[model samples]
Target: MTFPSGGRVPEPYGQSSGANLADILERVLDKGLVIAGDIRINLLDIELLTIKLRLIVASVDKAKEMGIDWWETDPALSSRAHRDELARENAELRAHLAELERGRGQEDPSLERGRVSEEPS
Candidate 1:
């Protein structure tokens, strides 16, 4: 199609001859962009619900290039070492909690009978 200026417009989309969709996508991935928004549900000026969302779209190489590869070592991502460390930390916390409860004279009777539950920590 032709514009009022007598210049031909690119078909399908407004992309000019100097730029293509692939170039746009490559730039976006190479230089990460964050799309963040907040949604709130308010009733009579009292917010009943608030949700915040943040999204980043990038290629794996780009993500790693930006030092954003947390999933590689995250416990939830099935990293055995991280999972073990988390398990140890959780056990320590539970033991600390049990000690505190005992100090307060609140002990589970089953614990005294060597019948502790199989629950973690």
Candidate 2:
């Protein structure tokens, strides 16, 4: 541990650096990390295909801080989104039914009398 300068030498690749896997992961999640890459395939000097890939790794809080909360509004991922979607659909259906009823009433004067036309047994 002694050096020529009479000071302790820093350990090489040792725990003293405090760079363990857990520590690295915690830092990554706290600060967030983005990996971006592009792959291109060319034939006869012409670009045929290109693929762009982006990946981000972070904690939920960090992701929200970065304004990346698509999961919250995605119906497949969020119950609240699914409920909202259902409510919207229900409202649309109700509106359509009311419109149809109004159209039918205009065509049949008996419908405006509020009389239920009983069907034959």
Each candidate's root-mean-square deviation in Å? 10.5, 5.3
Worst 10 residues of 1 by lDDT: 112-121
List the pairs of residues colliding in candidate 1. none
Against the reference, the lDDT scores of all candidates come to 0.82, 0.90
lDDT for position 78 in model 2: 100
What TM-score would every model get versus the actual structure? 0.47, 0.71
Candidate 2: misplaced stretches above 4 Å? 1-19, 108-121
Model 1 stretches astray by more than 4 angstroms? 1-19, 75-121
Would you give me the overall lDDT of model 2? 0.90
lDDT of 2 at 13: 73
| Residue-wise C-alpha lDDT for candidate 2, range 16-105, written one tens digit per residue | 556577899999999999999999999999999999999999999999999999999899999999999999999999999999998886
The numbered model that scores best in TM-score is: 2
Give the lDDT of residue 115 in candidate 2: 56
Model 2 — which ten-residue stretch has the worst lDDT? 112-121
